[model samples]
Target: MGALMPAPQSKLIVRACVGAAKEAARGHTSRASKEGCANFEGLYQDSGGGVVEVSQTKCNIRARNAAQRWSMDANADGIQVFMWDVVGTLRDGFISWSNQATWVILQDAAEAEKKGLPFLPRRFHAVCGPGNVCILREEREQSCRTRAFASRSE
Candidate 1:
């Protein structure tokens, strides 16, 4: 409906925050997704597809025949404390973040409309992992990689 709604095949950006998935659902867009969508009904069509699978569980609700086939080794807490990038497509009204079919992850919600942060509408906040901020990016013509540690000053 607007640029904020993002076009299909676009990337999503989630900025993580601490809150209940239920509250996050109530606090998020009216679209219906999975998990945290406990209280919100009839407000928005069940347009969003796929459930967000956890890192350890190796689950994806959108895949018709997806199997749990990822290694659960190498747990890192550092990834939990900061934000990361997720490249996904917005089909219908759903989002599926994937690593070239490696593993698909889902978010309980997107865009904290009430967060009141300058970056709120520009990012996605999901129930994935430690609730860290997630940013879906636009597919660039050129691939690039940049890494930064928040402990260090910009």
Candidate 2:
């Protein structure tokens, strides 16, 4: 028999992951905001050749005119990643931080997608602490886990 096609839900997860990465790259290469923070929202092509919308915002209390803090919206057809007061610039550390966080979620999501396993939309929060370490927690769960990303010299 021919290989089975990935389920619709699985495809969406894979697409969202790819789209999230694209969005992160776009945010990184665009510019170093004069405000020292920016809000990025755009469409990205997914792994399966589909369009996915992604949005992100980063802010720091120490930054100039830092109006917004940080927020992310959950979407069935897209992905969102948010950071608050991350310690470095887009080229220096933000890209790596965002990618690492994306990969953490994507690792599980991709496995389920590859296996064609069913999945429900889930929300995750990644909070970065000292030493560039982050804790990712699912919105529904009480427990938290730690993941570390390399920190670039500022």
Candidate 3:
């Protein structure tokens, strides 16, 4: 495991502790995601991933990470560590109070294809940003309809 600094403009998928947060926000008890995950939601909204119900355009990684810390300190780890993709150029390639202190950087794009998809267990490698480390210990693949997604011009 390596570590660097989190960058601006990142996409992160985290399991939101929606039970309490939801109850507080909407005044109703909420259930976990259908996959038996605690709201495996994305902070950044993008149609790139087919998980519609779980995907959003808005970002809230900072809020979510802070909440997860609060949960761990207050209780056991309420949120599960799910895999994520965080890609962006950092402000100074170092952690700072003004920016996120942690990063979950996946292998560079060129490196990923060379060793097969980075999502594969063996091929997976990441660097934790400054504050702490985040790794994908295990992942449950969620199947989706690929045809619905427009091919990336890149």
Top candidate (lDDT) = 2
TM-score, candidate 3, is: 0.19
Of 2 and 3, the candidate ahead on lDDT is: 2
Give all TM-scores, in the order shown: 0.19, 0.26, 0.19
Question: What's the lDDT of the predicted structure labeled candidate 2?
Answer: 0.29
lDDT of 2 at 145: 37
For TM-score, the strongest prediction is: 2
Could you give candidate 1's per-residue lDDT for residues 24-86 as a string of tens digits?
Answer: 212222342343221111111111222223222111222221122321222112112111343
Stretches > 4 Å off in candidate 2:
1-110, 142-154
Q: Where does candidate 3 stray beyond 4 Å?
A: 1-97, 118-136, 140-154
Candidate 1: where is the Cα deviation over 4 Å?
1-3, 20-154
Question: Arrange candidates by lDDT, highest first: which order?
Answer: 2, 1, 3
Q: Write the per-residue lDDT of candidate 2 for residues 38-87, one digit (tens) a residue.
A: 33233322222222233434332111111223223421111222335332
16 Cα displacement, candidate 3 (Å): 22
Better of 1 and 3 by TM-score: 3
Sort every candidate by TM-score, greatest first.
2, 3, 1
Give lDDT tens digits, candidate 3, residues 1-154: 1223234343222322212111111100022333332322322111111111122112222212321232111110112322233222211111112223332222222233455543221122233344332222112334311111111110
